[model samples]
Target: MNKYFLKTTLALTIGFSSLGMLPGTSQPIEVEAATTNTQNNNQAVAAKADQLIQTGKSLIGKSTYSNTVYKPTAPYKFSCATFLMYIFEKNGVDLATYNENYMIQQGTYVTRNQLQKGDLLFFKSKKTGTDPDHVGMYIGNNKMIHMADSKQNIVISDLNSKPYYTENYVSARRVLPTLMSANPATKGDKIVQNAYDLKNKVKISTTNNEKYLRFTAPGFVEYVYQKSGVNLGTTNLKAQMNLGKTVSRANLKKGDLVFFNSVKGSKTPSLVAIYAGNHRLIIPNSDGVITRVLLVDYYNEHYITAKRVF
Candidate 1:
């Protein structure tokens, strides 16, 4: 619908072996639920980029394209690069210029393969050159959103959807680490905020007929984090432990993922909890109830690691 960004299906086509392809649709690429990202930094970067994209998407219907006016607030008007610049500025990054030439020339150069969410993608306008004149923000699923031109409104386009972009695409730049530094509410903060809000809301799934509680420890953590926009992918315990920045037990934060070696059953780190701060953690107990437990001797003796995945 017109409510969300990218109302129309882009005419993009590519071998989405990495990203998943909908059963019948070849042009529409879906987020690969199977192609899991293991690196915590990538997850954090993707989360931040997705958040920025969602925020920018909220402005789609309200803005228009203009080369002369580069305002991003009310009655927003901007050219392709200016539009992207204004969006980044709104998201706490000041790129310092609305020009695409400098836009492509500066920032950390991201290879086509290493592109992450929130990366600035620049492309040639008329012909290939040293610097591109058009730009867009790379959202996940190989899609990017930008101000097309004066005749077109802001829209989402698949990187492979249009020949122009595929052929003219020059480079990408990342500014998330810098942005995260400037913003106090880090990804971990957002992740924990979502967890606390869902503490009471998360319930045992009624559909699954498993004998144990509605969710396994890893399943619960994945669900809570996923709802907050970080896809923890698989529900396997080892996989969950593999996510996020590993931290020492001494450096645990509010949202750090705490893993405990199996004291009763399962393998090492059989238990997991969401750090609730003040030396406390909330977990789904075997009694099928969510409760707060302290980092006592029992937990410390079996403690594994605290992961920071935002």
Candidate 2:
């Protein structure tokens, strides 16, 4: 709903030129690396596009459009930008803001000929003039799904079928390549998935006598891992240190047990959390709510070690 004018030129160039294989070897070292990265990116983008499209489609007729405010919860109500934000976050990609002008500057720019599924298309209408005031997702086949207006709510429209869309087309941004931090395999990670499901739903309080509130920091870690078919046998903090092979901080993977020393003089770990990839940790906050926090500063200074059980 925040309004502003487009600050940059919309004309963009594509940068993904393929490289030929090297001599002697079927593929050069650099070619192999580039190919691998491209393949991984393609897989990630495809999965994210499917997820975003399906989620948006599911909300059609059930959701309403609003350009004045943003509704973060269910019984969906959204603006053009906020709608994209909601669907992207639901699929583990965060667009970070709901302002169309600011969002117009995110990620890489894609030419019309290179348009792919999941690319965000920005447009300007008569009311907005040349400023980027509207946004939607390119759902392939030269079509886009957007929160058109209050009357239409959420609907799919053809880009070429409408003269208004073609005349007002401003630019497009490909965010899936950069926003989708995890590959397709990470979506299939049972440990990570289980941890995500338990976020904000479980408690970390050790002293609460409630039947459903018996989880400590270690207990929470143990429960999530156990739910994923990996049994650490005990919730004891020290016992967990020897449960799995040690993993270096640089080599840490998602779902690894990241231990930290909470007490000043304690040599062993007093707290444990799951590494949720992208420098994020899933740990219980002081209020006993399971949440995610960046693993920096305080976490960096109190770093102990990590273990990969799965």
Candidate 3:
């Protein structure tokens, strides 16, 4: 882990009080927005959170952290709190807080069991002293992405498996409503468009023919989502199924992940697709390219849960 002293630098861009929505003090968070009257607004909120997570995850290994300088304009070390401030403000959230303690308390507190994707998780550390000295964003399940320290930079960790996180874990809070950009539903639409955009770009190929690799069944599915800023983690059918929020088939949305139990009549999903609004889903044909399939009979028969990963 990278080490940092509790020293402040004059180059720090934001103080604890200078944020989009300052609560008490410390770090920054995506504050809750007023309840929206339209489904579009709700979609917008989801879209923004999805984007934030994607953007944050994408920054892993690229961002550096420091206890001194707080230049968030890239090429600067980001402390635990300033790292979040940089990510939020960089992605249109407009937040500027840099105190870990102040940042975690910026949203409504939620129980551990009630935690969802895009929640702010706080931890107290000797390095930070008082309040929350360390912070991270809950991605999904028990996984989180945070700036570990000066050595590790940005990384993803399993909250359930890590003893350090479990010991220091203080609370989780909801913070996505305010960070939303306009037309988040468009993110889903773009994901759909990404699938179609590469419809014929790839075709099924095996190791014997190394060139047509991106055109494989699972590859097609993963590539489409990757184009939209979300990585499904792996191309394995079963592994991919466990990546996002599992939604009922009846509740499938445009970007919902649809799956099917195609072999041995297994109860688990064996194949997957991107739900494309209406009754259609985008899947790979035998050639390993994008094809539209309807959940009419065959798919509806083998359909499993639709997971909303983004």
Candidate 4:
């Protein structure tokens, strides 16, 4: 028999044995014996139930990424929100089309105490209010798989850590079908891989009349122009600049923010952007537009460390 079936059968058998009272038995000795057997069986069933629970947990933990590239059964590549959508899809749950707006609209929007494994965590940098700036897959124990700014890349993080996220904790959304599934591997692995790829491909540029400062490097420039509603490119550059300060490049990640020194000892770094893993930065240099550039070129003399903003 399959492991699941075998375990179920064993548990039932133990439960039945514990209730040792047999039909058509009026004798005191037989009744006493049945009661004793029933107690023993009950203990055995409890032990078996605990073991099965632990085994299931272990299997869930093992369902993680290998080096292989994931090709979703669906057309689009996986993302933070898309990953959850896929899990629900695989489990036979039909959701609205996979989009950021759709997910946000469908999400339950609960507090941290309501969070469980396989929930979605949202964050923002604004202090007074909770504006959704970033999204991540919550994997339990206060850890999540956020795009993690432009420098940190797609990695796990603690929700209660640092300045911005800790204070700006928005809300957690639990995708139900995932909890009902037998396997969570495909969804989990795809989410992590997609987050990593997103980090690599993030490009920062200029928009909304923002000035694009041409750095000395070929095809590279600092996106000095800032405008509303523009997507910052990489994570590294974002981490450095999120705090409006300079940080060491060595400590940067794919989704981190970056900053450059235009003026000495100034709180605001002259140029700010996101770190796109592989030594690239994305910034909004043009008016209301974001662009991407090489890190070495952008920070040749003005290289600075990064800080976590999400």
Candidate 5:
């Protein structure tokens, strides 16, 4: 049991106001539309949001809620905040902690009338007093899905269906933008997308072929760049590291080549990976499978330098 989960309660019903198009907005004007690449990126992010909602829906009957305890693994057991932590982490957006007060402090505040799907909803109930004690994901149509209290497992409820939600609603925070903004439709996004597309589809080998290989971390980065029309020209990690404009770790954009010292305490670069934005890296494992992983702990500690080649 944790202090954060104490005094939690569930409100059975709720509802939200609908937002419709403005009354006089019925004509197309001569204006440029969002770039095709950006549109695609937005679509991809939106798809991820939909997937987040579906993931929460899938846990409905299988998850058990408890205000007194939190079990981080499945078969699942959760508190309201931990439930958000689980679903968001499953979709690659780490909420980081299972504390509602801390979570409410994250992302950016959003007005209740402007709530969008995937926004985190925080509320204060009679038991929780002035502090926000409950959290849930806004799942469009003025509805939200949450691990409602010890009585209700994971379930959905209309926001306006009960006065408890409307009257006590504390606030909402928009975290989807954190994921979406990192993937704006730039050439780098295309390169990162190519890397993702090639994950398990390519063969890693020392022999070079027309279809692509010279298999090594450098080769994988080269292949992904070539597919997206940028040629790095060398298979040597150190040589590749020297080919592009030098970039600091903090300014790295998607598709930037992040070089690292493979040997502990060595300054020379022995490995390279693609920066996939939002602090994620696209690199291959020993078994030759490419994967996206968080850039924390191990990778952060082995940091050498980065370069923007694309």
Candidate 6:
């Protein structure tokens, strides 16, 4: 047959003969053949691993790695860890046993050097030792994929590149299957098109008043009331409240006033407003004034459920 198979067969025949197991009998030869088959199977597994790594890289910004606890669309969206789950799943690996939180916990407790292609990566405010605030997938070669904070979008980043990732570098864990049967690759255009298509299928609206402006989603509305002038609490209030509603739900235009609230346990509110895609939202919270977060940030497990109030 193939050269690899022939070589493996020859190697096994010699090994069995040396052990005195292969007498001048047909049965001994049959045993050697079976042993060769097992070696070939192991080699095939190694090849599959390499192929899966390449597949993961191709899916970089296109596939969703994290689960959308509140997905308004199908095929679903992913976060870092969830995206890794998808990659592993596509390759025939099963990880239904672990959820996002479980994966994050494992990543934080594990060491960096132990990371592999399908492991999880996490990040957070360097000043605060709180929960792993952000998550991503470990795709080997010191690189990771994440739906980065509001500004970055879904992307691949160098593990040691950004100051936050370098200094606050957490942990990584390997949980993918040892072998995958099929591999599918993704491209950037397909990802953008998918996101755009989803956005178009949904309904979005915007409204304005002399003092306040707002955008509406399927079930939620975000409003921004003018502040006499920008202040710390007022700034953060503007951002955290209407972060997602504008771009995602209302398709906001320039010069809009985004609003925020200072309610405790309500670090982030259900609705927010926007001034243009460029003007960032700001609000006062336990951690002081925070600004410039995406609308999806309101859906972070840490924040309250988002509702439209246009």
Which structure is stronger by lDDT: 4 or 5? 5
State the weakest 10-residue window (summed lDDT) of model 6: 11-20
RMSD of 4: 23.7
lDDT of 1 by residue, 18-43 (tens): 22224553232334322212233656
Q: How many steric overlaps are in each model, in order?
A: 2, 0, 12, 72, 10, 32
Q: What count of clashes does model 1 give?
A: 2
Return whichever of 1 and 5 wins on lDDT.
5
Instruction: Please give the lDDT score at residue 1 for candidate 2.
Output: 44
202-264, model 2: which lDDT tens digit per residue? 666764323584577777777777777888888788898788899899897778888888765
Model 4 lDDT per residue over 31-119, tens place? 11111112324353333323322222222221232212222321222334433333333322223233333344443566787675546
* Model 2, global lDDT: 0.66
- Cα lDDT of model 3 overall? 0.62
Ranking according to TM-score, highest score first: 5, 2, 3, 1, 6, 4
Q: Is candidate 3 or candidate 6 better by lDDT?
A: 3
Summarize candidate 3's per-residue lDDT along 27-97 as a digit string, tens digits: 33444432221244556566556656765765565568777655544454677666676555444443324
Give Cα-based local distance difference scores for all models: 0.60, 0.66, 0.62, 0.38, 0.67, 0.37
Q: Which whole-number lDDT from 0 to 100 does residue 269 have in model 1?
A: 74
What lDDT score goes with residue 247 in model 3?
Answer: 86
**What are the models' TM-scores?**
0.44, 0.50, 0.45, 0.30, 0.57, 0.36
What's the TM for model 3? Answer: 0.45
Per-residue error for 81 in candidate 3, Å, reads 1.1
